[model samples]
Target: MTSDLFDLTGKVAIVTGSSRGIGFAMAQALAEHGAKVVISSRKEDACTEAAKQICDAGGEAIGIPCNIVENDDLDNLVQKTKDAFGKVDILVCNAGISPFFGPATELPDDKFDLIMRANVRANIHLAKLVIPEMKERKDGVIIIISSVAVKKGNNTTAYSISKAAVDQLVRNLAVENSPDNIRVNAIAPGLIKTHFSRVLWENEEALNKRLSKVPMRRIGEPEDIAGVAVMLASKAGNWITGQTFFVDGGDTIDI
Candidate 1:
């Protein structure tokens, strides 16, 4: 029975932005652990392909395209997941955007608002949609993918600010939902070798500069964050709540 602690049999999970990168990895990991997974992103083809990959690997999965910035899409995503799988036991708010990579002061008002809406507000909306069912069931897990950028001031200020808000959102939600046995947490990952992060990691000069701050001396892979999500979603993390786990290869701790 002890071995069953990480098992997620009969659980249903929805992972946003799961077409690729960290979101896809988390969805795959959850599915491998016996949870039925919904692979969702803005692109239907990408979502379908990602879900098919999981299914090909013998995991139960479905593709549901969702644009997280849209309230209607978020509602439909939750409703469709429930319609297909019965109930959502796990929610991974991994979809986010950082359209502007400039100084905070120079960030356009529109871009700043977009970053906040997509990176911060979207997660809050999704959580609101799923928490009621979680309360009714008296069990649920919400994992938002934050960023290590929040730890330092950089050109990516708008994005960093958005993630900071997300970190607080996790804490606040955890405090509010702890009484209902619901857990809300976040994962703040450092520079990873994902398409979304290619700009940071692909340039040898910039990559080396960033690596210097990471004690691990290397970039992370999507799988690096997936394991943590598994732990947080399963019984292994039942006692843990309202925390942000940094999977940045020691980048956050280094000077």
Candidate 2:
């Protein structure tokens, strides 16, 4: 039936950077929709807390601390998920870093490298590591969490470039994996109200300036992105692939 198309029962999902904020919200949403979720982050304590919150909500989740910047950590995370569950049915490459906030000229080279490694390289690494297993099974879904800044050419030059790379990564992977029945997509969110974007949303003057561009006339919540993530990971999106969905509350449209 139509309702069953979105059902995710028995599926196993791994959401990186899921200790809190958008990642946690997406993990919770997947769990609520009947998927076993792995909540991972750099801090074990934060991961544990997120797992507990999901469990309390009557969903199955396990905390696994993983620093995406480290390949060994990512390998351990994949191994632990296979050991704990059976397989990884879904992967949300949401772990990213944005340490700098100025123009590209003023941004430090080290910081720029950090952003490239964490936001762009890590996502490709994780996807490549998981592809063999998914190919063997001939089924899987990979979702990359991108930013609307890529489209708007935001002031965070390094971050925007990295995210744009992620968008292309999704497209390339989707093309490569489509014949194998694996789907890959990216979600570019606008100004979502989260700790990650607190500096932008918290400032009254900046918040109003940002809001004026969005026809929605408000900021987005983690839940807003979470729902879309659920849709992409479930059977409802089986026919969808190679797309960069802009969940920007009309910000991209206005600009």
Candidate 3:
């Protein structure tokens, strides 16, 4: 009875890039808490496997492959999820990319464009597409998985810039839709043990260096971020909107 506040018994959620990593963990968590989850990513095989894992665990889930950069794919994702679940109560924009590594001055135009497209433009596209339905229902939640890289300095210049843009996007969307009962927010995770962040946590020297600054003395895991996603999407976070959660293990504070 005490846990009922977080119950998502009748909610449906769409999590992009949910085949693995933080996205997969959040999808699984949401499903476990009673939301019908739509697991999507660029790879059909991976999406299928992720959905199976959740189902095998007795959670409601389905796989829908999508490449977020493509508008057609985003359209299909929304349509498929709505067909399968009737309505989307939650949207997790977790798909992101950082295709280049260099100083900001040395960054190439193509790489910058790619980063913006994947991290910023794609989110805007998905939100706009989903907003109409959310508006109709007079209820919705959008969680954009931004990064702590935007707060502290990261070697990936374009990536950080893209994330910063996402933060602003959250603010603008939330303000615009708050009156309609839609809540928009961002989660900034730091050095989580995901494939996307392997370069920072896999190497011994790099791992130790990162850990040294974190007050927790350990790197974050996907589940750490997943818990917050559940809150922000469920009744537990009903009053919260236009906020960015820093799930970093003190990385942002130490910096």
Q: On a 0 to 1 TM-score scale, where does candidate 1 land against the true structure?
A: 0.98
> lDDT of each prediction vs. the true structure?
0.94, 0.92, 0.92
Off by over 4 Å in 2: none
lDDT of 2 by residue, 1-255 (tens): 797877899999999999998999999999999999999999999999999999999999999999999989999999999999989999999988899988778999899999999998888888888899999999999999999888775679999999999889999999999899899999999989988999998889989998998999899999999989999999889899999999978888955
Instruction: Give the residue spans of candidate 1 off by over 4 A.
Output: none
Writing each residue's lDDT as its tens digit, candidate 3 over 1-255 gives 567878989999999999999999999999999999999999999999999999999999999999998989999999999899988899999999998987888999999998899999999999988899999999999999888988877689999999999999999999999999999999999889988888777799989987988889899888999999999998899999999999988888844
Estimate the overall C-alpha local distance difference test score of candidate 3: 0.92
Clashes within 3 Å, all models in order:
0, 0, 0
Query: 78, model 2: CA deviation in Å?
Result: 0.5
Work out the TM-score per prediction.
0.98, 0.98, 0.97
Error of 2 at 119 (Å): 0.7
Span of 10 residues, lowest total lDDT, candidate 1: 98-107
Best by lDDT: 1
TM-score of predicted structure 3:
0.97
